[model samples]
Target: MPNIDATVTIPADATFDNTLQALRRSPLDFVSNLVQTHDDDIVRLPFGTQDIYLLNHPDFIRDVFVTKSSYFAKRKDISAEGSYLQQMSGVLPLFEGQLSTTYAPIMTEAAVNAHMRWDTMHQQRDFLKVDIYKEVMQITLDIVFKTLFKVDMQAKAADLVDAIITMDVGYGFDPIAALLNDLAPPVTVSMTSEAQAAHSYLLNFMLGLVEASRSAPLDSRSLFSWLLKQQVNGQPISDEQIADQALKIIFSMHEVTATTLSWVWYLLAEYPNVEAQLHTELTNILAGRTPTFEDLPYLPYTEMVLKEVRRLYPSVWIVGRFVRDNISFGRYLVPAGSIVVFSQYLMHRDHRYFVDPDQFDPLRWTQEAQAARPEFSYFPFSAGPRQCAGRDFAPTKDALVLATLAQHWQARLAPNQTLEPYPQKSFTPRYGIQMTLHRR
Candidate 1:
């Protein structure tokens, strides 16, 4: 641990500026290069006046999120507007009890319904050229919206897509933009007028859902109902608060689940051997039916593939946390109020933890293999109190979605398109994941 207290700064000059430009252009490549170039546990990046500490070492990351989790808090008011580009923590599910179980059937029906729609389209064209990004995002939106709110907004699905695109429109420049413009909001570009409009549309949509849930039966399973019924402090979560949080859930769930599923399809296309094993697991497990909660346990390989996909292309690449007072992790002391980041993308690929780090090998996710590693080394949904509230829901939902489609349809990458990961808030394919569908 050579001089852990000391730091290296990438200035606003040519070398560092070029990297910053690359970061804005291709964050996946930028940060990968940053980690490779720094080759140190902690790297200091200067974005105007704000100092960013990129903590790469697993132990250091553990200290930040778990071992000393209380020493850090989610950054408040990172952006002047727009839900921290849909990454803020307070606006999402607080993990009440057994949400995945309560929501499982809705999740299954949504996946099956998505397949039926594809099947209908496929009847007309032998091989449908579908954009996995769009389709998956739409399906997850349907799952979240319909399951929780008990309403269909299919007419506005296009608007939701627009919202996702525009909300994500300027994310890459957030770090630099925040600094230069004195916005100081990490990891988000300023909201565009278009994005603001879309945000308003979603808020209005969710507000309507909140109102509907107020009169909903006490036995209803809608998440909006759940939110309305619960009392925070002494009173129930407000309608405005409900609307704000509903939009946050809508933004986070649809984007993350959709992007992960899209990457799963892309990876399946690139690695046939892995795909074969996955299909075999589905075949032996489900035979020829849509997967549900019961079938998830037996479909271990399918879960492994999803795990591997998340490892390679995490839905959330990095999360921001404010350091609390004096903190000592190993030999380094991260001062309070400094912005520190721990990236799953970096740790998932760290050589010390993974062999053939870049390879998409699902077998590496075996129980024994997982048990051998440090707890924080592979936190795709994050860890500690701030860990994803949807942890149970996302995995089961992802496995079911993967199995539902992979069981009957084989989606291949469209030959002519450039299939590069877009490095968005989630790892989205830049050109969209265009695939030629084939019956399994």
Candidate 2:
């Protein structure tokens, strides 16, 4: 048994009313402040009858995700019937071994097509001034759609984008509700009418695609077609199962990559020095041509820029898992039935692992610099077996998209607007990024 002497629990009484007040104000800021103020590696926050333990050290994070992963459950109430999200999460692991081999060629083709589409848009002056976040979101939606279903979704992009945003807002995390649910099992949470509509529209949209594929000749290259042909216990998978996986893939591919690419443009505009280095590298490497999968190995600096953006603003900033059994971190014992949460936002910004953590420096990702830091100190896509299934695909897509656009144009931030990070399902800009594109 492990000793619990070193564990520190923040009281729930009036003395720490400020913590509760801060939490009400902004959960992200509250968690950040709590981690910084306490020196302990593990800090527990008591709410009602349960405790939420924040793991602040890298080793503890490793233990939760790697060393003792089986002792943690991804969802708090695993015994309950799995929701759509739960079903998606449970099914993702089945595709991990096949993602890189099956999707790399499709991603590369999509990236080249994205380049051609942008070139045509630029010729028509449509890329001159626009909301880049929305633009990238649409681009990613099209790319992911083609990659998954081998069909063009450009015609329905507008409706799909609207539905996606609605779904995000509708299903976005609510801390207060989460706390209540943990304190009391199976809380009946409600969604807005808009969210309900979005939910129905997205589900129907996916179902329609699945239905259409049943009669169409199967594309040897499409993930959707491949999934449709998959068998379990010698039986083909169900339409609902395929639809759920497709929806999950859409969210993973579109939202995360779009948010990262949006930040990439914003950061490049903010730091001309890094942008200059990137341009020089791209010019030297590709000489004004669209990049391919083969060009990736030569574009190390470009990858570094994407890495820095991921470090500064990870799409999935925080991840939480429920402790399945008593777990020990050094001398501290974390009891079963508690939620153990870790923040990539906090770990990436930690001063111990990074020098001037807030500064956007791509050189920090240099092999030498990376070797000097602890392995778990920087995990934007997370680590271990449960890491994102698209971990290999997202960066490749982001790099290609970034290389394609930056090769011919530079985005300048539009005048008179403040950019703030909104801690949504993905860390998105509260007000979308507005910019004017200048030909290079």
Q: What tens-digit string does per-residue lDDT give for candidate 1 at 198-305?
A: 778778878887777677664345566556765556787789898997786787677677878889898899999999998887888889887777887898898899
Poorest 10 consecutive residues of model 2 by lDDT? 178-187
TM-score of each: 0.83, 0.85
Clashing pairs in 1: 174-188
lDDT of 2: 0.76
lDDT (Cα, tens digit) per residue for candidate 2, span 1-440: 54554555664442334544555468688788777877786778764455778888889888877999888866566654134245446446443544455555655555566556666777896557777887788778877786657778877876888787776666644554443334323434567789889878888899899999888988766667667876666899899888887887787667677889899899999999999999999999999887776788999999999999999999787777778888888788788887778888889999989999999999999999999988889888877756776677688788877887788788899999889876754678767788987788
Cα deviation in Å at residue 249, candidate 2? Answer: 3.6
Q: What is the C-alpha lDDT of each candidate?
A: 0.73, 0.76
TM-score top scorer: 2
* Candidate 2, superposed: residue stretches over 4 Å from native: 1-5, 12-25, 77-105, 112-127, 169-197, 217-245
